[model samples]
Target: MRAHLPLRLTRTAAFAAVCVTLAALAHSLGGGTGPDPWAAGVGLAVVFALAMALSGTERSTTTINATLVVTQLGLHELFGGDGSAYVAAHQHGRGLGDALGMLLAHLTATLVTGCWLARGEAALWAMLRRLARRLVLLRPVATAPLPPAAPIAHVRDVPRRLLFRHSVARRGPPLPA
Candidate 1:
């Protein structure tokens, strides 16, 4: 059903869903202070960044470039310590330092993911150019063998016929005065 949504809307909704799901998961575990929730968030960032990089193939990629990154950061900060993460941190009795640490980790992950994406974009661009060049060189142009000639056929010798097949009896024209 979500497929019906516009791409941007779907991705925005998915981002929201991720944030909500992460919060819910933290809550389920009694708070954002799980053993290494930030690590999990890092993994999520990696997946998200990879998806964004792969999505470079789409036309919308250019339009939604900054939006994607901003969304990730906003969601990260929102779900970070003292924000949505607070709920989990409070419940788990995690110290302020830990919460801050977790936030730091998330920030680092986001930045790293973004950097990886930058590198990935350059690499893909170079690879695409290389691929295009190779394709052009390897393309079977004049080097391709010609197809066998087809057998010729004799033309039909049918004579032209009048549209009206039956001849009408000629009515004698009235003598001109």
Candidate 2:
């Protein structure tokens, strides 16, 4: 358990960093002319790949999605975007409600793409998961501990002797008689 602490922490930190970075990029690109469609597609592809690679389970995917939403909202509040104006001009809304509504609308679209990407990844990695299971299943079995023996009345058997002539038998110390 202790050994896994650093790995978990590293994964968490890295995911957070990516979320923040992506949020900032999204907020920045979402401003002004509302980003080029090509750019948006490329960005979505990057997000899909990142989410698929980092998210291990449904819970993790939910957490990451939440993180992305929250980070984007926070950055939008701090840096301020023209989303309100854009929404009021194009869509039929205004003010904070409009902004939030637009945000939610975009969130739905983004999440759909993410879901598609995750499903694709699941299909692709199914084979990898099976391979992993096979590797574990095929691993060499550890030798069982020898049972304790009663005190020997006679010493006919040598106390220590090589159990087998092959190098494979030397993988561990020889078992006692």
Candidate 3:
């Protein structure tokens, strides 16, 4: 269980966005009017954020799909407006067609979102694995200690004349132009 804190937080944010957007769209289309859209969006965000945090990284496609489906259903119900209005709408012969349409839309959205998140998860994990491999390969290797430096000869004892002998002769001063 790698601590993918950034990835987890990002996924949480994406999930929240999806939840709020889809729920709001579905609610409006279904003729459900809510008092506060901002409150609904924030509520969805907080709920999904907590869900994602508890669920951890969803690496499996099936798991992602399942999670998304549940989330969509929850959001749909949440934004479905007041119970009295919902009951009145249904009582007035709002048949199965609307319900079916909403379900279908939610399912479609879930599948698409799940596929996208799964693909991204796979790519990110693959990149992380490659980076880990490269880092391991770059580890410093242990080697035998370098040989000690040779001792310097005592140059102070050498005669200065001998050292200077055979040295380059001093150049004469340049002739006047």
Candidate 4:
């Protein structure tokens, strides 16, 4: 069964909040002063939610971490500026310290978000399993025993004339011999 709407929404909100927070932290640490684009954050959140919903709930921790890393990088760039500005800044040689700071922030965010999501995934599956078990247990049971069937007559016990008489009925009249 698919996840409920409330659960999906909560998961999406959590993901978006973590991404935005991490992006803001990384930007500030990298000496950025501009505000992040709210539109970008909302767009990314919608995309992320759709992807997660389509991908199903039983994702591995590694997969979650990898996705988080990609999202963090994308958000960092989006927050820093548009794609072109980020590329230009990188080409101009950002300091190693700034690079390390951003890396550390992204890494930390990935680890934390991955763990949180992994735990939630496990719990959801476990709950679903328990619910299924309970449903099975609650199924209606047949309490009454079935009636016994009639006994069959052996072919050898019946007379041959009686069988022939029963086989062909005298409808109207017998055919002319």
> Model-by-model lDDT, in order?
0.51, 0.53, 0.69, 0.66
Per-residue accuracy of model 3 over 29-100 as CA lDDT, tens digit each: 555564267658666766677657654644688876777777776766666556677656533345788657
Question: Which residue window of length 10 is worst by lDDT in model 3?
Answer: 86-95
Tens digits of per-residue lDDT, candidate 4, 106-128, equal 68867897788778777877898
Residue-wise C-alpha lDDT for candidate 2, range 20-126, written one tens digit per residue: 45554555555444444554445445544554454444333555456566544554444443557644443444577776787786587546544554464445456
TM-scores, each model vs. reference? 0.35, 0.39, 0.64, 0.60
Task: For candidate 1, report its TM-score.
Answer: 0.35
Best candidate (score: TM-score): 3
If the candidates were sorted by their TM-score against the true structure, best first, what order would they fall in?
3, 4, 2, 1
The candidate with the higher lDDT, 1 or 2, is 2
**Model 1, which residues run further than 4 Å from truth?**
1-69, 77-104, 142-177
Q: Which regions in candidate 4 have their CA more than 4 angstroms from the true location?
A: 1-7, 25-34, 40-43, 46-50, 53-55, 82-92, 142-145, 149-177
Better of 2 and 4 by lDDT: 4
lDDT-better candidate, 2 vs 3: 3
Residue 49: error of model 1 in Å?
13
Tens digits of per-residue lDDT for model 1 on 1-177? 112225434443444445435443544454424434664566456545644444424323333445445655554444444654565554334677876765665455445544554465556456767887898999877767789999899899988688767867778888899
Which pairs clash (backbone N, Cα, C closer than 3 Å) in model 1?
A: 31-88, 32-88
**In model 3, which residue pairs have backbone atoms overlapping below 3 Å?**
none
Clashing residue pairs in candidate 4 are none
Clashing pairs in 2: none
lDDT of 3 at 28: 62
